[model samples]
Target: MSKGLTRRSMIAGSAASVLAAPALAQELPDTVQIRESLSSTTRRNTASFRAIQWRAHFPNLRNGAILVDIDSRALHLWQEDGGYHVYPSSVPQSAEMTRKGRTRVVRKVVGPTWRPTPNMRRRNPEWPAVVEPGPNNPLGTHALYLSWTYYRIHGTHDTRKIGRRSSSGCIGLYNEHIAEVFGMTKIGTQVLLI
Candidate 1:
């Protein structure tokens, strides 16, 4: 067989090129509609994730501030000293279940017990009325009770719930994240859900 320009070599090179064509063709989308769709999606996902200054939402960080961005599934906290931190969170499952505006962290509990609210019981008749503080507790390891009744910024054992809309009417964080927030927050910490 000839060393160069053989029919077998040409056929093999052609086959390899054919097999690689689809991979090489997978380039960035260029169509206007597709580009617009991707742009909108990226904006929707990232617009809320951008770091927000506390002044935009609060007059002062007296007792510290907690801003829950439901749309982004994130919680942003500003310590009284101007320290800022962001954490992924789980938000209420529906608009009706969401409450916007201001509230305070009126209470903080570690190893918090879980109780199905009257409305919750009505909605989930089979759910237990009380859940003692433990692994099965929905409030995870800590809870920050809001001024609004039945509303809390708490922890969840279900890690999958973070960065999602899974809660009935509360914001949820990872147990570890909540533990960190719990340590830094005060009873009078300002809380806002938006």
Candidate 2:
């Protein structure tokens, strides 16, 4: 092999590195920072209370990892300790939107506003251009924005929708559950959607 680097070789090398990078480093860090956690002290001590199915679902799951099981309609935050917190989640019913992959928690926000996408507005002409954060807002009270394209794991205005498939692409959790998940996750938290 010669010492000189070719353009094609360099491009290939860069692509290889990107493809092999850790899931957490796949995206740029967000401007927002998580400054607080929800009931961390109390939740960490409940490892003994986990059900057999929960443990069986992830035998070697990483700590501080967020796993979203689309088929099961559940979201789990594996605590820094050995315990885990499970919450019912509502995933998208659209086959094209039910994606399987890994992403990172890029942002966390309380009282998130809902901006109707152009496509959404096209589908529903009556849909408001923007919905300010409130009881009626679909984003509920908290949200964990993922690195994936326009997808967020957020709280829902309708608690009855939990454990059901009824979203465009984002994962929906109960208002209270999302609040806890928002507190539990931080920037760069690995989110596996399966």
Candidate 3:
């Protein structure tokens, strides 16, 4: 074996900083790298799965569509090769998550501050009125605002809540996963909440 960087090194080093892409390595975020598989590992059991066995042949959506599959609790970033990027998500209750229409990405922000909605405040008056951008913020690292009223796709401080019905009404992802999606998605991107 040689002492130089090899293809195997890059794949194995995906999680660590030793793939040795020196200059470009500095630009890599500490966030989780994109999954080469369609499924995800649950933080709860580590060994257990969330049944995200999707193949990403987006039935109706095209390559550019962002499909948030509530049933699968997985978000698929439609790709040109019929293989999509999968991100685990914590969806709102079925009734609350279904917007019954197509919406477009309205705004995108990094390190978004989270201000409790009036409804959220009414539900929990003791909750803080606002949370500044930080590791503790409800909207972790980044957010993608939807055209629909108060709905958004954002990161969460608690990754354990992902792959379940945990969010008030918006979709939630692990901070790292949200970072990947936020970077790939752009304004005017079609969002189907179904």
Candidate 4:
């Protein structure tokens, strides 16, 4: 073959080989930005539990947290960046333990008053003549007030009965854990139960 024709043939063969290769065989397009996670310094602050003295020996738990697993009767506190603490929980005998939606934080109030809902009243006619917030309240030492429908993750006065089916539809944490969490979390954080 003529030298010029040979050069053209080689160029055509090279082009065909390049086109036949898998798309992924080539370097990623410049438009695709490869992202790296934040440095250690940028990780979420390990929540402080200074006010809850009982946790002095326990390590500070991770990022944005989580709670409740109906099937397991376990409450898991998860951090957004990745870490979790699991504790046994209790669900109500009458209350269904299904997690319907996203998880969020219990940002405010400890030892919240128990104002039994009209439904709660209907269930237990003698629930309370009038409810008030204090240590004597069934809510125990802490209640994590969530953003959706009057729900909370709290400590129950009855600790011996945890890890079973038994609350009015709130996620129950140990009193000590709730106090620590109540101090660390803030309003408007994400919460999920599954």
Candidate 5:
């Protein structure tokens, strides 16, 4: 071994250089590129996932609060004790299908059966009137029924729906996420869709 270097040192240095090479090869973005990306629609959409104060939307946590941001496709929950959680969600397919305002969780159902609304049936004449609780059920494994007749915060088996505007009117979360939310929420949990 040399006075200042050894086989171990050489091997470690070589490994460090190899690990750093890809990072070094990548060029840093210019100011213009950074500015353009910041202003892009994608950035605007993703920026919606940022944390929001519960007080801005809710008068009080009461039983708890669930805030669904339609534009950002995100759901936020604030428990009465100040616990906070956020999840990516699926919103209504279009503005016409969206119902915005305050509502409460009127019911919580596990292994929920789904029934299409009259309007849903009218829109898709071929669609089934009843869907039993199963993998094919649009409601997934859990649902929190809203005060509004046809609106719900539920789970979707179709994961691609989350973080996108793909629901008929309900807010949809991944099944596992919904199950977790289901356990956290109560029948009177406050909900606001905006």
Candidate 6:
């Protein structure tokens, strides 16, 4: 055999061995045929699985709507009737404003600006009056502002803060997760904060 052919075959064999070990470790049953079929296509399958799980978990909501259960720390997206998804979230410290109300979505802005509110300014006098949206902004890549309130359900710069009591008063979610919700939601969609 040619030297190049031998090298290619060795690399291919090594790659196959590495890929096969994980499958051997799991030893999945035949009943897990769906997982087996998706083994090579995990990302798309996972996204779809999560989307279906969200719909099943939050069945009472209508399509193009959402229910943000702060107490449960979950965001539910209602796509088309009975179609939707859920994502874990981080909300404001209940000890702070302790607000518990609902409002309609006013807008969804990607890479939203972070303007310090009067209260924010008071709390941190050194904070900039207006911080343009970017990686450094407290609001991450997406911000879904609500009607009749200064509050927003937006992505957070501090991603690790998700699933915790971290924000000043606004709802915080993972950047990518908020982006998913942003696409499914629209202006005037009801956002119940309970």
Maximum-lDDT candidate = 1
**Candidate 5, lDDT over the whole model:** 0.80
Tens digit of per-residue lDDT, candidate 5, span 15-125:
455445553243222111111222244334444356677879989888999999888788888788776667778899999999999989999999999999999999899
RMSD of each: 14.3, 18.2, 8.7, 20.1, 12.3, 11.3
Superposed by TM-score, candidate 5 places the C-alpha of residue 182 at a distance from the truth, in angstroms, of: 0.5
For each candidate, what TM-score against the reference? 0.76, 0.67, 0.67, 0.60, 0.76, 0.66
Quote the positional error of residue 118 for candidate 6 in Å: 0.6
In model 5, pairs of residues that clash are none
Model 2, TM vs. native:
0.67
Model 3 C-alpha lDDT per residue in residues 101-189, reported as the tens digit of each score? 56778899998989888988997999998899998898899999999888899998887788787888888888888888887776877
**Residue-level lDDT for 5 in candidate 3:** 79
Scored against the true structure, residue 62 in model 5 reaches a CA lDDT of 86
Q: Which residue pairs clash in candidate 6?
A: 111-141
Error of 2 at 11 (Å): 56
lDDT of each: 0.81, 0.69, 0.68, 0.56, 0.80, 0.65
lDDT of 4 at 45: 16
lDDT of 6 by residue, 1-194 (tens): 77667743664555456445553243222111112222233323223222223333433454366666666565666665544456667777765654666577888798899997898799899999888988889889999998856788888767667666777888887787788788888787776666
The better-scoring model by lDDT among 2 and 3 is: 2
Candidates ranked by lDDT, best first? 1, 5, 2, 3, 6, 4
List model 1 lDDT by residue over 1-194, tens digit each. Answer: 66898854664565455445553242212111111222343324433465667889999999999999888787889898876667778899999999999999999999999998898999999999899999999999999999999999999998777777899999998898899999999999999988
Candidate 4 lDDT, tens digit per residue, 20-63? 66533532221211112312321111111111111232233333
Model 4, 51: alpha-carbon shift in Å?
Answer: 28
| Number of clashes found in candidate 4 | 14
What TM-score does model 5 achieve against the real structure? 0.76
Please list the residue runs of candidate 2 whose C-alpha ends up more than 4 Å from where it truly belongs after superposition: 1-63
